[model samples]
Target: MKNKHLFLFILLFVGLVFILSTTYTVLAEKDRRYYENTGEVVWEIDTKEKVVALTFDDGPHPKHTGEILDLLAKYNAKATFFVVGENIEKAPDILLRQYNEGHDIANHTYTHPIKTTIPKLEAELKKTNDLIYSITGHYPELFRPVEGQYTDEMIESVVKQGYKVVMWSWHLDTEDWKDPGVHRIVKTVLKGTEPGNVILFHDGGSNRSQTVKALEKILPELQKQGYKFVTITELLYMNNENEK
Candidate 1:
């Protein structure tokens, strides 16, 4: 009787473990699939072309933004700048220069708010859109949520405002926001980048000297690899073409 009871307890424990493991795996897989789908928020493009989109956020910084622009010019590379509305207000000419330089200017919200109501989020996006339009005479068709933090309601709001939500490839995040050393930033980006990647960087936040240094190394290396830098719109267009 004792042996039978022990055997039954062990069997039940094993069964419970299997059930829990299976449930965890299924949930994880579902989350992965949800993020990978390109119908709405695009993470990366599907293509054979050696092209990548270099995107800067929280920008129009008084100094860093210009430095980044100069670097892009040096390489004759184009990029997409997701500018904050308040920053644009401070430096309208910089935003205008970004437009004049032929780089894509997109909306990153009027203010960088992490948590807010759907109505507030919508207003933020609209304000930014109007601001950019006021300067460039064109409203941005692309919107990247502040900090890539978005709830379904936030996404729906942006979509209703007639913008495509953009996200970067997970592996391509340089973590430059942390102000990690320049070498690390360069290594992280160059090592993780592949064809059709959307590489993320920042141009507006606290001292971006390290980011600038990393770019010095990153651009030449990537160009040497034959990877052409294009704006996010071009990358998306390439993706759409490949799908067809």
Candidate 2:
């Protein structure tokens, strides 16, 4: 009777161990699958406000940045500029102007390398943050990676540096980077805009005259439609308030 009891106890213990191990494996796999599907990156915010964010990347250009700034001022609109460190170094005055104009300036990496290792990304972010602080007396609270390319490691690195990653909605690409004429750029933005959308434009890395022209048209039209242009920070803040 004692031998039978011992055999039964061992069998039960083995079955329990197997069940626990299988359960762990299944949960682990489920978590991995969830991360795989849901980890792409934030593209937009869902809100009912008739407000949108206008964000310009790769800028602080001598001519284009100034032009965009003037246009924003004309319309009494605000924007965020994701500036490259190297460009800021070359045009600190432009960056200073952006800050002085009450526009949000964010990091877009130091050299704008497409794909980078962890160490390199850290270096890029640190260098850019340092430069921005030197000019604006504050480190950037926001960051947008080069070309909107993000990885798990990259996101981790950015978060470690105390930045909120920002992407856009309603791209409004304009292909302005391609110098695709002023009319095309204007049409694209006017057509693509919607309430709570974030529009993307470039004010650097090539001639951006078309972008300037498009903005002249896009800004007034959006304003006429009762749309308010806010910075990314403001947009997020509004969403938070609504959630609460």
**Which model scores highest in TM-score?**
1
What is every candidate's alpha-carbon RMSD to the true fold? 6.7, 13.9
Q: What tens-digit string does per-residue lDDT give for candidate 2 at 1-244?
A: 9999999999999999986643422322333334323532344566776787888989879888999999999999999999999899889999999999889999998898977788988888889889999988988989887766566666667776777777666355556788888888888788878777878899988788888988988889999988999988887777668668
Per-candidate TM-score against the hidden true structure: 0.85, 0.82
Instruction: Report the C-alpha displacement of residue 43, candidate 2, in angstroms.
Output: 2.3
Off by over 4 Å in 2: 1-41
Model 1 weakest lDDT span, ten residues long = 23-32
Residue 69 CA displacement from its true place in model 2, Å: 0.6
Question: Clashing pairs in model 2?
Answer: none
